[model samples]
Target: MSEPESVKDLVVVDLGVGMPSAIVAKFLREMGATVWRVAPPAGDPFESIYPAYTSWHSGSRMATPDHLDELLARADVCLIGGEDHPGLEWSFEGAALIAANPRLVVLQIAGYARGFEQRAAVDLLVQARVGLAFEIFSDRPVNFACPLPTYGAAIQGLLGVGAALVERERSGRGQLVETSLQQGAGMFLSCLWMSIEDTQSVNMRNPPKDVWAPIVRCADGQYVFFVPRYNGMDKVFAAFGIDKSIGDTAKKGYFGDIDLFQRYATKFTHEELLRACWAADVAAEKVLGPGECWDDEQVRVNGTIVTEVDGRRRVGTPLTMRAVQPNSGAPRTSLPSAPEDAAPLAGVRILDFGAMVAGAYGSKLLADLGADVIKVEPLAGDIMRTASYPNFVVSNQGKRSLHLDAKAPESMDVVRRLCATANAASHNFRVGSAGRIKLDPASLRGYRPDIVAVQCFSYGASGPRAMNAGLDPLMQAYCGQAVRAGGRDNAPLWYRNLYIDYATGAIGAIAMLFGIREQLCHGNAVEAETSLLEAGLFLMSELIQCADGSFSGGPPLDYDRTGFHCTECLYQTKDGWVAIAARSDDMAARLVNVLHLQGFPENSRSWGDSERQKIAERIRSRTTHELLQQLEAADVWCEKCNENGWQSLLDDPTARAANLIVETRDPNVGALITVGPLVSFSRSRLDANRPMSVPTGGVDTREILGELGYSSTEIDNLAARKVVA
Candidate 1:
């Protein structure tokens, strides 16, 4: 398939700084949009330092701020980075821009949701606030070596832009769309924040005990990670010359005892164990550094990592849609316009067969866009409903629920009927499970030839471990993420949050959108697939590249002891803590003046060890408030560390003004305050006043069946037969 013409006429003005903004532009460019990137007269600070900029900013035109008015005159969308960043003052004039061009979609990115919008924040500080820092290193807060928060925020920003464009198609007017690092982090880690009936039953502070842990050291002193399935454990044990029955007993007795398992695992070399596991058909892999992933055969063959014509290597977006065929001469169908006051996906219908985080979150994203989502549940309902109430509520909000038994023949007919009415359907069942339930693409297509089907799994559909059951932690370990972030000495720690699951959901949503675009361009359905493994790769892409055919993992020379680059790190102040990022020369100079570092050079590398220590000491002598005031006056990037947790945002002026938080009463959980929608359109913003409620499974089954042309008598018979709940 060729690139769709839908975005060909769209002109995007990218005035944001850094990789996040560049990422949004890259997605637009991929969809054939014309992006004109407006930088300062002096150019981006990272232009000469970061190779990611080179990769993300490719295929775009560059302009200076002087052309802002001219660019806005023709732009359909404008992406603005944080307000305090150098050369981004123009982005603050959203009201003026909309007055001039009422149809312009202005997307602003910020560090915090509201009150702290003007404060300087980098990826490190954002990660710290969201618990990533503390999660990665148990002893103290340490930022990931890569900028994951930035990427997360960027993906949300991209979704905002896409939704706004869809809204514009109907309203013919553009609006302001805003997303922040804090908000994105919350969404990315939704599963972790979930509340259950008995919180004590599941401990977020420690690793899960049921699944076998993946980390093991080899005789060669290298770490290897693998998820050994229970059924395959016998084979793995046999290959290692251990009695299967004895090994099973040991596993059952010492399930959560890491020390005991390690003692047993060390009996064999890492290479030997990995070979045995692979031979036994268990899901296993040697832990690889970011750079080493570039050479992995699976990554290379799947085009997960690509080498550009300019010789720069970068990770590719996991979401893929076939291009429109050239010279086919098929007439393109224009998407129908939404009605006034309609949501972006007002007319779209989605079938939610998702369970847990990956599947349900994808459907929730669509539901937020105003799609009519019918959540199909089993007779007993979604397992998460009982396991985690918060997870069930957040994932199924704004959708109607129906219950059916997939094993019943009559229920399969109901699923087919529903498929005939849905524009798309998504599920995260293991490979072949969808076929067993008659909801796979082949079966769904039999009902609706043009239905878009998205299937997500632990691994992808074609991998050797395609059918293996996996979770976020297991995938993280297997994909080298845990080892990379935890450093060499520590046992590979699972990310504190469900980063993989949320990322997979976001990617799945993108895939569904692309599939919809394909159907609009060509009258055919598309099957979209993504995996937790792919999400992990995309998150760690910034560090996954090779230049000299060699691979190693270590902190850069500029790394600070506080978990950020020297120019951007957390520091102690007299009264409290502050996070600073004096990335540019100008900002560095301002930082020097504010901190009274008399003899220190702007380049941190130029300072002697003693001099650097002295500078830190001097800064530590001042109060956090005083330093923040001084830094703001000097235009240096900095913010006081927010250790008060997410509740602090409740009183934030910017967050309130931007509608970043909302209060609603839930039938089961009572009054609650939750993060609001990531994007806000001038006309089609979600109704913050609407109570978010998830009805019990089968609550609407009878109504749904009635709508499907089944009479009361037929519905009764189906229910009596255990076909429909």
Candidate 2:
């Protein structure tokens, strides 16, 4: 009720005329900031519903208002998440706005691109900027077509904004922070770069490229993605119970050739091979299909998959930050939008009906920031509930749930009633005629005139695939991600798991925050939409740029293996193998100087791939401990590459320090390791493992009925009829 005394009370603004902005606004509010949004001028609003369609503006058509400079100066943080083509009016203006905001912190979430225009575009927004400009994309790798996590980028984008605001207080100046969806997507495909660089080749023609971490189908027809490290191969060889003679690197030239290792790996059944691989700490896991993650013990225990909707739970967000101990000398960060506790979206609520991974996760993130997220599920629950792999417990933590078959008449009635309640007045806002929840624009208008509504359908709520079912995999196919993933040649391969789902979730959350911001500051509905297709393309923007040769700060893709030297590739040892990431000349010298190794090879063409293998073979003759000690002593950022994404805190000290994973308790699933915060915030910290106290589907229905002043008998009748989950 009191005026906000901190930064959380300031209003958020959504410049683009769409849902992504709305999502961003919603999250900002929940993070304790008021939001203000800007829609397209009247009826001439932008037509595209998806961020994918909206983000590709390349040319000069992007708007550059006469008062743009003033607008940039007025805001603390300005985010540009759309296209950079010069042909579009908005693109040029967006870039110009970044330059104009001398004191403003700007974040450009774009992809890696090539060509002069693309490079110029990068320069305009990111290049040579005072602050950080991050690129997240999926380059050409064995599993390049997988969904990238742009949704998380949105979270990072907002986090960048918050960080900028905090920095502004101390420095009295603003800095630029830029990232691209393509860059984020690229992170999923980094192994390709690792391989290209590791093999001491300018191009991807290295021997390792000849080999693949393939998912071989067993006689039972089950598939498992496998990529064995050095030690894993020995066990894999032993697992098939065969004598492949790959154990020692001294006699043969097998150490450098990954493809050679695969020849032997393909001999066993998929299941048999996996057991062997696991026993040897090789990177091998069943290629989880959609919805399959829910059934995994890791998913259940980690609280990634969860129960929802009349007792049928599904996958939710994978990141959580717990509440900070009150008054621990760590002053709570304040937002100008709302008062201290009320500072960040203190009284905001979100209704999420997204069935797939991305949308579902996006809503979960808002909840993490303190929004009351009511996860609306279909009668059968979210499709993710029945997803084959079923890792819902890890992603779906800490949220209330409700179920309604929107297609059914009675269920639709319940939805309408709930929407009506959302439209109604609350203590914080002026008493409204309607409540907040609404299925239609008209209903939302009457409900909370100042509220933001986030509708996260797969391809968005309209157009060709408006009614068509959408998810990460299909979208990857549609957006050319699968095609580009194959690189200049080769066949496209989709990355295992719900890749696009996580990305879409994060983007959806950004849109919600933008919409909510628009509502609180200059009350109006702010709509933005993002799809897997758009997100995929957005994250890979640099790829487009690179293909066109318009990127900057680095040469266009070139291939040269000469002048290369190092002990950086995967080294095999008798006990186990460890990957070495020590790649600098100094580090290389340190590896030789500190380890005090023998048989260091001399430089020359004579020491090509074949010779390089000879040196590696000699090194592998030692133990992992010996090599690790040598690298550690040299102070290189060396880490044993756990090809599998299963490194525990104990195994990886850095992961522990970054708080990448945590132990969380789930109502139905119990305690398990869940992924930690993607980005950390000193204050306004949400629990990494917040308790999901709301019953799967009990609270939403009960709360709504009670608020509608429905009698207990009526509520019981509805429950009996199964109108609510």
Candidate 3:
């Protein structure tokens, strides 16, 4: 456990709960920062419930809020959580703290932003407000068994803080950083929000016809999940003794006659089916529930799960960077003056060969960090330009675009030449596609032996479905996420947001950063691999567990006609809907007092069916404003379920203060307002407020070629030959 040289002397103050703040503390600690965690007098609320809490705050020294001022005076960074907790008013306190400590870096995590900053929200509430619930359950809103919103936000928070730290290295100042569950939800479903086409408009929305659905019951009553590549479908059909002739047509029709295939699938046991599928080169895996993941061979081999010294099982960080060490030290608050024109990653150069949201977003992240990114595309442009312009804009910002037909010998030479000069290169092509274009790690390494290479695939590099084409929806269906979220009685549903894709993008960015760090430290290049499937598994890590008899699934679904639970979900009020959380004993007691429910028990579970019904009725009897006032005054967590559009966020003072939304004019889209950068810096600021406009295909082709030292005559000849655009 050697510490990273860059963060060797950093000190961080961890405030609030374990969720986002603790998660941030964990990452910094891993990077070699000494973390001092400030817990409330009653102790951290999640300490007893979430095992990850202990894992994240492992080496941090714990203290009460009384030491907050002293800690801040010596801290390089401070992570604050508990936006909804009544004991802390972060908005005002944060402002005061920053005023007092001009160089302090404060990162705050909240449920929502703007005018609703004071409102209480958890993962479940954020998911419902952002359309995840409606997408998962057609009848009503249901939270995933896990806390995806918070986890996703936590990842972004880490990235935001890291970027700010990079900026601080140059500017010698610290700034405030903020992120929220709502923002995380947007990133999770970046594709859905940006795409012009809605999922419901397609015939594939029906679960029966969803070609991506992978769960199939075998003869032995066991279940297996598999994803077949375009060409592998024929082998799958043949293994089941079905005519391969129908494979192409079935695929075109989104798995035509699903029932017939299911009937045929029943002939083999789960193990037999998996064996046959693997023999035929189809990627498959057993449908391991949350309780069964611990013993999984692949999971263990990948170090995705680890048993702590205390014997508690915990999830491990997916990305690995061996060159960097993990140790403990206090960071230096001041350093030598930096260059006036310094950018966070001014000296780094990256070659971008990705399309669609995942690869493009990863490159965009690098570009935002001040890396010189050159985007390589085909003559037809990235396919996503036509599929979703908004997505293209968001993912292609701050990069120079070039078009090259890799099939041509001249284009292949140009790509190799580019790789020689680049510090790193990234692509999201299906498994074998990179090799065809001579952009694979081996080929790129031939040009620059120490160059970093990053590859993103749908499934993974070694899985049976490694070469298969996949998207967010498909991965969700295959990983049992759709089934778990949809519940046992309902049809598996796909979340409209391409959360897995964006999450993969975030992970990809981290991997690239690690690669850069490795080169800086060890003077060696590294190749990193990540996939949508792997990211999905990581997101569900906290929930996956083995049931050892003591495991009892939390309270049964308290589904009402409106699709929310009475005790801990959204309820209709006189004016509008309000989301409330009164599941805990203290909160339940407060709710009982506020609503004047005479006979309702303070113990949440003691309430009978009739009592629950009475509470719902009483809640509906009052207006949203009245209920919010009563609940909030009584220290209960609640918020109005905002159904407004993104435009409304612009008017929020807190959002504006934090620079959460930026407005920029674009040549193609006219005036544009997009989500701003997640973090802020005092002396140096990354302007995410600018429109991330998409450049026309080959818009900078000649310019980039000129930089590559290609002669004018050669460039013209290549353009004439249709090799360069």
Candidate 4:
């Protein structure tokens, strides 16, 4: 994957609203693609909804709608909000546009599942409908502060576009790509399905118990997210007069109780406690928003976390694509080609040694898209299995599992043999861990000289905190997401959504797809990388630097604390809750007129506590159905947050109609219901119905070795020697 200096040869037309479509265009623009936006000015990301994000992309512009045909003629990809935003001059029809440009890839982004699309494409509603609130906490659906589903949709969509481009190189024809907030939300919602298999475990996990409540309050009143999971943390806890109940390792392969120091934590100041935690190898960091983390030494030095894009500090691109250096006299191998009517990556093979959240999500996505991803694991099995069984199955499903211990030299030889049959590889090893096992990307080249390797981790590849252990919660605390919604003097509010963890996986997949494109188009092997920190920033791309040395965007929770602004916020109705995203004055006017709102101020800034209370009272008197009808009729975005979300999944009729929800029956696990691959292609299938292989645990060892030409006696000898589990 030769990542040449520029992607100036590619052109993209963004005709969508909000972050999902905008972020995709921004990435291509950052990579030198000619991006043109011809959207309704009010909702256009380039103009109003997120000027803070577009301001930095000076090269991107909002072209006139009349020029859609011209842009489509030469555009490699055209992103649209939905069927609603069709071209006024020509109907902006997907079929018509693709017909005009046979090579153009059209991507449609919506809020609901595919067949159920006309439901207002609002992020909050989608998050609510998917039972996000319940998934993280109680059994009832509740409202979420941020549009996390939107971010998840964007990254998945980004991968979709990239994969389409790679597939186009093979079939020489373009296709229609479809994705939605439901599909995006489903990525992290994988755990919901776990209840069907292991109800007890799902009942036990109550994710994200607070707005950093488990946080240690230092003497100075600053908050530190401390998870005392170090090897000798139990002794350190005793020394500090903290709780010593979590003796030895805190839950091996998972986090320990964070409240162990809650009672005694205030004895030390923030810095003092931080230093102590670091010295003791305990995971701890001061809680800060995305903007505050911008100045951290590790963040600034690595430059990707709060990167300077055109002199403005912004959450830059998540992917780092570099040209691979071929050996002195060898040529890169030609990339594999997908068979006609097959999935986008049909013939592509991946040796995935990745496990846990980020790695599992990314490679599992690759597995769904027809990549022969071999889930290579050590004999001890993936620790995620021990930490959360349901979580493990959701991420590990749809792929073949093999147990090959990387530590054993003989096992490593078998790993090398598998690598020779793979064109791509990935891992989430902590910094420097892979090299020791001879599984690093550079080391992989010795087996498949032209392999495209994707390596992911916390922090950066080479920073002071590079070797430090980190997780989803720490990322939220460090990069500001945890503080985005809570802290009503609560100090540090954490989100229940594992959005950053999920997005990191999608970004990793994006990097992998980009490398695949490089391999397919230019016959080049590449080294691509992404991180949780980078993915977290990308989710909050609204945060940006301004000329006055001040940053703008990523507003805190509103007065109601349910959304950012009054007009674009959540409200409780007679029967349920409804989310509204009528940000622009035009849409707000429609909302007021439709709801027969009286004494409503034109500016949300004018709505103080009393005014908000009055409006809330009025809305609370009306049924959700009445409000949805009146609001949507006037073009105002609104949706009744899903109240029966749990049961809804049992028979998601719309998802089934759209083929977004499918089933696979395993010999041992019976029938497994899942939120299948989000991206849908008109020309090819994504193999969403593929059954998950049981956790390998050496079940496939003999077959895998036999495929590599190992004799039965040789395999018996290897097993006898304990090389292959």
Q: Note each model's CA RMSD in angstroms.
A: 4.7, 17.7, 6.0, 3.6
- Cα TM-score per model: 0.84, 0.51, 0.78, 0.90
Per-residue alpha-carbon lDDT of model 4 for 428-544, expressed as tens digits?
A: 899899899998888888887767789888887777777888777788888887677662454666665566777887787777777767765655567878888877777778888
Where does the lowest 10-residue lDDT sum fall in candidate 1? 202-211
Write down the lDDT that model 4 would get: 0.70
Superposed Cα deviation of residue 373, candidate 3 (Å): 2.9
Model 4: CA > 4 A from native: 5-8, 39-46, 61-70, 82-91, 133-143, 198-213, 228-236, 243-260, 305-311, 328-339, 586-597, 604-608, 623-636
Task: lDDT winner between 1 and 3, please give it.
Answer: 1
Model 1, 279-375: lDDT tens per residue? 7776666666555555655555456676767565776766654433323443433446655766677777889888987888887877777777888
Backbone collisions counted per model: 7, 169, 12, 7
Kindly report which residue stretches of model 2 are placed more than 4 angstroms away from their true locations once superposed.
1-75, 78-345, 408-417, 420-443, 457-468, 477-491, 546-619, 643-647, 650-665, 687-689, 693-695, 698-700
lDDT of 3: 0.65
State the lDDT of candidate 3 residue by residue for 1-725, as single tens digits: 13234454678888767466666676567556689987766655566445456676777888777887898998878887743443433433566667888777777777875345434657666765655444443333445454566766777777666656655555666777667777666565443333222323222122221233555778998766665454536766766668766545454544444565678879999889888877877666665444355454544544556555655565555554333221223121222344654445665788999998888888787776667789999899897776556667668866888999988988877987897678789999887888887898778877776667888877677644566566676566555565555444544444545677777888777667656655554455567777886776666544423233232232223434232245666677877766677646778788888999786666665665677677778888999889989998997777666554343455656655654555555555555555555544444545454335556678889998988889999899999999999
lDDT per residue for candidate 2 within 1-725, as digits (tens), equals: 21122335443444543222333444454334544443333321223222222222221133334545555567665655533322234432444655666556555554332111232122112211101111121211121222233443454566446444543443455555544433333223222221111222112221232333243555455555544342334654554454666445212332333444445545666677777766665555544323333344433443433343334332233222111112233222222353332213334566666554565666655655556666776667654443421234334555667766555556655655555444111111111211232354445444334334444444443344344345455554444444444433333334444456666566566555544443433334443445554454344432212223232111111111111222433344556544443333445545655555445444221233564565466666777677667666666534332333333232445444443444544344343444444443322344544553323444466775666577888778877877765
Alpha-carbon lDDT, every model: 0.67, 0.42, 0.65, 0.70
Q: Which order, best to worst by lDDT? A: 4, 1, 3, 2
Tell me the TM-score of model 2.
0.51
How far off is residue 679 in model 4, in Å?
A: 1.0
